[model samples]
Target: MRRPRAETRWAYVFLLPWLIGLVVFQAGPMVASLVLSFTDYDLIDSPRFAGLGNYAKMAQDPKVARAVGNTVLYTLSHVPLAIVLALALALVLNRVTGRAAGVFRTIFYLPSMTPYVAVGVLFLFLLNGQAGMVNQFLGLFGVQGPQWTTDPDWVLPGIVLMSLWNLGSTTIILFAALRNVPKELTEAAMIDGAGPWQRLRAVTLPMISSALFFVVIINTITSLQMFDQVYTMFFGNQIAQQSSGDAALFYVVYLFQQGFQFLHMGYASALAWLLFAVIAVITLVQVRVGRRLVYYEAEEHAG
Candidate 1:
């Protein structure tokens, strides 16, 4: 069943473009960035070796601490809610056995496909302090709407809400996972006099744990890199001096400010490395924890 040498050569030839691209574009830049992280490299001047200066400064940087805190807060607030909401929607859609379900799925997914800038703009207008639709709706009930973008206390919540608006993709992913759950298992549970909740707890959920874990990992990675919405909504003149109590100041946004806005390329590279480290640790932890929960029908098949 082994390939001939000629076939193997052809396979490698086909992969040559990607291999070359990795070296030239991906690997080259990554290595360069690592090197740059150790130096003080302003765009206008040659990089000077500074060893751990950038990292040392990071430990003492108030802005970096604030950005990290905000990012963590946003992730903790948004990811769990998004996962639950998406899974609930997906479960509902999975039970619908007609064209209506398909239409509804597409409608839900449409927002995720829409451009981030458009979503940011739409939310900004919708959540505007005095004139926004959300506030106006609240006014009808005599409940004053908080300044979502401008008030520090409300800024992170606004960003978390905005992030939830694109939960369609997660819903679709969970829907697919739910569909793959074997119906016979649920029927067996029902035959044992199990109710709906019992069936789901004993059968459906365990079957889809792998997919759920995957979604959590993907969401964590995405949340750590959140930038476009914050940049589009609050960067520069749009950001009031003390907007949202600085709640919207995410880690990636701070990195962007350091590298592009402040021209602290070296420092930004260090921050990028730190972000990578955090993500790596988190992913490892997820994998370890998931090992206990993830189930595979293939294992039963093999056994």
Candidate 2:
């Protein structure tokens, strides 16, 4: 007990930098933003108290509804597709080993490491309606592709497709999870006359449920917070004017426009807080649901 005090002191010493950084950089900004959410403050002028005015204005703001709708739609479309694709890639990669696995892993992960700005720019040409690679490939099969950037019906789907480029991290995580499943359990299941599908359904999925849960939450968050690619591709200086109406006006994008372009810092902060609230509620619900779904080997061990 006496020695624990000295050990705890050293632990705190080691943790001091991280604690300081969290308070200074993260917690500080969050608190400041919270306060700013209730006040009017352009970058030029001092903050003026507005109480719930900024938030109340959001109720009547048509753009807020549009932004939220677009974001939710994108999240719905992107999160499941990303997870399924990542899981599929992981399952394929899980069967391989040695140098071949390493090469494939690197190849899949390289696209994710590419900057979103570059991805956005590259995709512009790839998704172009007139003479893009994707259209050319589709044309080979007697199918014509839609104008990805211009048409309202196809614009959001294009964004969702673009979002898949960064599923490499999710794939790697699921791959690691798949590799961690106990071979003995699988072998036992096989001995019991379980077919490939049965064994996978009963053993593999439950074993990796925790990872799937994690990927779902993370991908959902990423989908909701999508900004970089959208901005770089559709909302840029020379491109925004050509965008097909409100199909791509995600919540964060609208927040950026309000805060920077229109100088509505208070309104932007309010929007940020609203998004935070939404994410918090959704995460809480997911956690509640996941508690029953996620299989924990540790819990079984402890029992």
Candidate 3:
């Protein structure tokens, strides 16, 4: 039987605001950016159609390559570490209960709510080269700490360290997943002579695989777009100096410079599209690979 027209009309009425926002704000700009990527628009002048010229330039751009390399390195360094740390925190918290667990959970999550700019500035002071708190602490043990913000070799690591502070959100998600996992499986595994590590590997991991997959995907996307922390800590308002800013010039940072600072709107649009393509491909690969690993409890019940 066909649904009544009046009811169908009311559903569309309720969805109108979202539909309008999607078209006007999200989908509209995506389409416009794709078209603009083929042109040479400097925001002031008219966009002259340059066909594939922008893409050809990107192919030979050394800075583009550097930016992409930096982004990939940052993603690799931060994502896996963040996931592991978050999962470990979740596991620890899973064993706790009552008022103490609530207090601990809030303490852990508080850092995630701190503004990125504030955290960046705070870390710059903490990780200072000579007079910083970090180096001073290291000096107590006679270990000289490297210049975190200024040195190229240590800048990425510094950023990764800051990234760890935001693991509260990931930990909460994984903690919920751990709670949902069937305890009977782990109990049975223990009864069969499985040790703690073996039970964790065989039972707990498979049960929470879906949550693990979600964390991996989310972290990958966020790490690739890391800009605010680097901007505040390394490049805000100051002239770009090779010793300090070069190491922190991430893909989004470069794109921001090209679009707003340099006024190369067309080139920036191309960069945006290229990043979009990369993200699309990575997400697709994750979904493909996830098919073999991520387990759904509903599917098990159905089987």
Best by TM-score: 3
Q: What is the TM-score of each candidate against the true structure?
A: 0.95, 0.95, 0.96
The CA-based lDDT of model 3 is what?
0.91
Task: After superposing candidate 1 on the true structure, give the runs of residues whose Cα lies further than 4 Å from its correct spot.
Answer: 1-3, 239-242
Name the candidate that leads on lDDT: 2
Residue-wise lDDT of candidate 3 within 1-303, one digit each (tens)? 356888899899999999999999999999999999999999999999999999999999999998899999999999999999999999999999999999989988999999999988888888888798988999999998999877888988988987898999999999999999888888899899999899889999999999999999999999989988888888873632356757888999999999999999999999999999999999999999999889988998999
Clashes of each: 3, 0, 0
Question: What Cα-based lDDT does every candidate model obtain?
Answer: 0.88, 0.92, 0.91
Model 1 alpha-carbon miss at residue 230, Å: 0.9
Clashing pairs in 3: none
Q: Candidate 2 has what TM-score? A: 0.95
Indicate the residue-level lDDT of 69 in model 3.
91
Q: What lDDT is reached at residue 294 by model 2?
A: 97
Which candidate model has the greater lDDT, 1 or 3?
3
